[model samples]
Target: MDPSQQKHFAVVDYVIFAVLLAASVAIGLYHALTGGRQRTTREFLMADRSMGCLPVSLSLIASFQSAVAIIGVPAEIYSNGTQYWFLGCAYILGLLIPAHVFIPVLYRLQLSSAYQYLELRFSKPVRVCGTLTFIFQMVIYMGVCVYTPAFALNAVTGFELWAAVLATGLVCTVYTTMGGLKAVIWTDVFQTLVMFAGQLAVIVVGVQQSGGLSEVWRKVQDGDRIAGLDLNPDPTERHTFWTLAVGGVFLMLSLYGVNQAQVQRYLSARSEKEAVRSCYMVFPSLQLALALSCVMGLVMFARYCGEDHHTSFLATSKKDAVVIFFVMDMLQGLPGLPGLFIACLFSAALSTISSALNSLATVTMEDLIKPYFPTMTESRATYLSKALAMSYGLLCLAMSYLTHLMGDSVLQVALKIFGMVGGPILGVFCLGLFFPCANSTGALAGLGTGLAVIFWVGLGSIVTRSSGSTPLPSSCVANRLAGNSTVILQAVYSNVTLSRPSGLKRFYSLSYMWYSGFSCSAVILMGLIVSFLTGPLKEEDVTPGTVYPLMGKLLCFLPEHLKKKLCCVTPLGQTISACQRQPPHQKENNGEAFHRNEELDSCLPEEVSLPLVEQETFV
Candidate 1:
């Protein structure tokens, strides 16, 4: 807190940070100058659909794992203990469902925008609505992502917040516009590595400086900072196993399953298997990222147990800045470490912002613009896409100011934004994919009702200022210094039992973690009801390849006639075989032979088929 304790960057530190920007730009320039030279929308928006699994998987991780996760996750662990780590449990289904379910459907459709499927299954209005909703979510989210590192750096170091924001935003925009999705994906690969390196450095140093891992463990244990499994069923109880593992699935679905940023990556993959493989690979990397963040927080707690190092930032209610403060305090004498961490922070931010800008451009051009102007030239479309990317990049800078006004923790804020907006999008996709009977009217009503309900809950939570359960105590220095290793302080200081809120206030008290699942359920439930009330869509009317036969497969144990009665659809295998029985000329005429590789079909489900009629019905 004193002037003497203020941390300053060394010459080498600045070099490292500068090099990060340079490398990112260089990557962009490389892609821009070579390989179609960003002259077509195919190259600009979808990377020519030739991306491999490795880069796509890494880019997928980099997409959502922004600066908020970099700094905010550590701050969360420092404040609330390791219970937040349980979110790692969510990644299993989060990545799996997207890999197996969402990827195959979207990939097979051979569509440019993920929302195109909305139009295919529902209507053009639903597609436009979904696209706008996604744009809204990403614009707001990228603002937070752009602001987080800059705000943190400005708080702990003397870095200019707006300058940093402008620098990252502009650099990201230039590269994203020039290089297209290839540059964005490859830069993401590089930046993701830097992100991991930065987090790892802090943990290695913090663990070493905090005596050793054992000592660090002892201090955290003594301070009661180690959280056990909390199995609370109360929806308002934040970070419990149920909320994290189960509720987290929907969160994952919202992001990985249906979010445009991730779906774009999936669509860019060379094949459906490659996309699925990339999603599978995300599991371990995500777990590692989660572990590093959680461990960094523990090490920080161990090093500064019972210390006032965090008080200055905590007093101002800048909980997000606490991690930056801890990093500065620990990395003071270390020369390049601080800069490397700063680079790590910005890399995370740039990766996210770039992905958002590109995807925003993709959806804007593909869903919102191209359909309305089907006769637009490719060159004109590419130019507009680049301009859209640049425009959105600039817009995110303005959005950062709005983020600055919010008081919630950055991680919570980011996840809540994902859930509140993304949940409904995921629900619409789910309604169409799993429920063939859900009509366009139902999809629209469901989407509207879901958005309205989630906004009410999300805004209510914000207005009520519903904080998480009491945090772990922040004092253990005396006991550690006095060689009292066995002493265990109470985890939380609260003793009074307060009465729970009732009615609307009780509903408002729901955990932010449950927002995705809760809102998604609202959409599905409302959608089915609305569909039945209005005439449910007949199986024959639903677009082929749009309905995934999820219900028929799930209810496969029933008699064939009974299954048909309930699911109201033909078996997937029968449908695929029936299509395969058609002659090559018939297949060509019908456009039902999108993939000719029998090997690839063996790898994916038989249900992964070409559209029976691609444009006529939908367009």
Candidate 2:
């Protein structure tokens, strides 16, 4: 209990941390030196997009499951309950849509940054708009990734939060900047093992400390602490069946599927089939991970529910320290246990940050930079890409500071930030893939309107949160008046009174799970109708052939019933045309087709064609 006391970092802790850092550096340098001409934009950006499934899939898992899943989930469950795990099923569903829909679209056309699709689908402005929004989303998310683990370490070891944030952030930036995606994936594979070890260790030891499964269950039920399965249909009531399942679907879909940070990993696979397999594998693994983490949380609360829960600095200090508390207290003398646990947390944290940095750089360099800096030199591009990587990392740091300063539930904060922009972004992608008739003008207007509408809907809730909005519903008003009993008059004046709690502030709040669903649906509906009015992009406007294949998938025209699965129908319904020519393109990228460097083309997805696959050259 010494306020001035410091938990000296054991030698093993230093050794483990040092080894992880050194290994990450070694991975980067090895790829840099050995990946022939890999130091160029071709190799640095994508690893040639010829990597097999295992490493790619593993990287995807490590990226998506960040330090948040490792540390944040347990912290959340320690306060709330396993209701959070209920959303994991929804997350799996959400993730599937992107894998099936967006990745296929990107593959057929071949795009380095998914943001480039925006330009091809709608117009140049739409591409820039989507890219900018994605940058914001990635920056905030990456910031959270950095902040969370540093926050966890600060809690256990007694260090300054800012210092910890900067230290880990700067080190993560080194490999990300130097090595790009190759460094990110190799390091992710390493971090994945450490993270799995750490999480499983805590779950094992915490369960043992809480007696055993039967005793733990008995204690939880005895304490009435098992908050499981509550199915209500109200969107206003955040954890309701509607919000968690539906809204959770949109949130996870946007995150794991369409998210550039997530998609970037999948595209690195040797083939589309391999990438699909990776995502399919992650679905069940995620549920198991969530179950384990939540079980550990229940055990922690069962063990130390009423202990003097004190934390030094995190804004939401109460439950935020739960995981760290459990580790430092319950997990005592296992030799190198703390070091392993810390590495696991950092691994999760850094893995996400690694993807964020590379994706941000990829998007900026490919989508944003190519537009404005047309004369982008490779050496300068690399230099600028690294600078942008650091810039986005720094931006996340600044935003994380503001997030802690404002005070928010970590889960709520993450969802809310993304929800603010996810709708329009998802809408743009959906329009590109599903609607053949959407043009640049329509897409732009639709994106703008969709964003404005969701802001008012979601952020408006915050107003009613502070002071009840005008014409508040009777149920809401009644709910407010019910709290009138808590009001009290000061001893000096019996008549002059005001409503209050022991501490009067915005205590009642909405859950954030519904944010993404609401925004996405709003945009889809609005964008579709708007596009219908504005007319579809002419063959000249958008690069042709992009829409036809995507439309075929949406309509189920690539006949799965046939042997080849590429059969077509004639105007005479009885006659199968047997023609699947992908609707002759009016030249997809014809203007500068010959001039564009074939070397850059080889690094792209289109380079992995049928004859090449038949040869099994890179696969």
lDDT leader: 1
Candidate 2 weakest lDDT stretch, 10 residues: 569-578
Best by TM-score: 1
Residue lDDT tens for model 2, 1-619: 2444235467787687768777887787777666554556656777777777777877888887888778767766665555667777686577677566565556544567877667655556787888888988877777678777776667667757887677667767777777777888988888888888887887788778878888777665655555556776644564656667777787777777578887787777767677777777777667776787788777876776434434532223544554775676666666567777878888888888888888888888887666666666777776677788778777767867866776655545565666668766877777666555565666777778778866665565564453222211111011223343535324325442333212222223334676566666666677767766655434334444344244333445445554124322111111111122122332222232211122233234433223423322212
Candidates' C-alpha lDDT:
0.81, 0.65
| Overall local distance difference test of candidate 1 | 0.81
Candidate 2 ranges with C-alpha deviation above 4 Å: 1-9, 306-316, 394-415, 462-511, 537-545, 548-619
- Backbone Cα, N, C clashes tallied per candidate: 2, 2
Give the local distance difference test score of model 2.
Answer: 0.65
lDDT of 1 at 271: 73
In the range 18-61, model 1's lDDT, one tens digit per residue, is 99999999999999999999999888999988999999989998
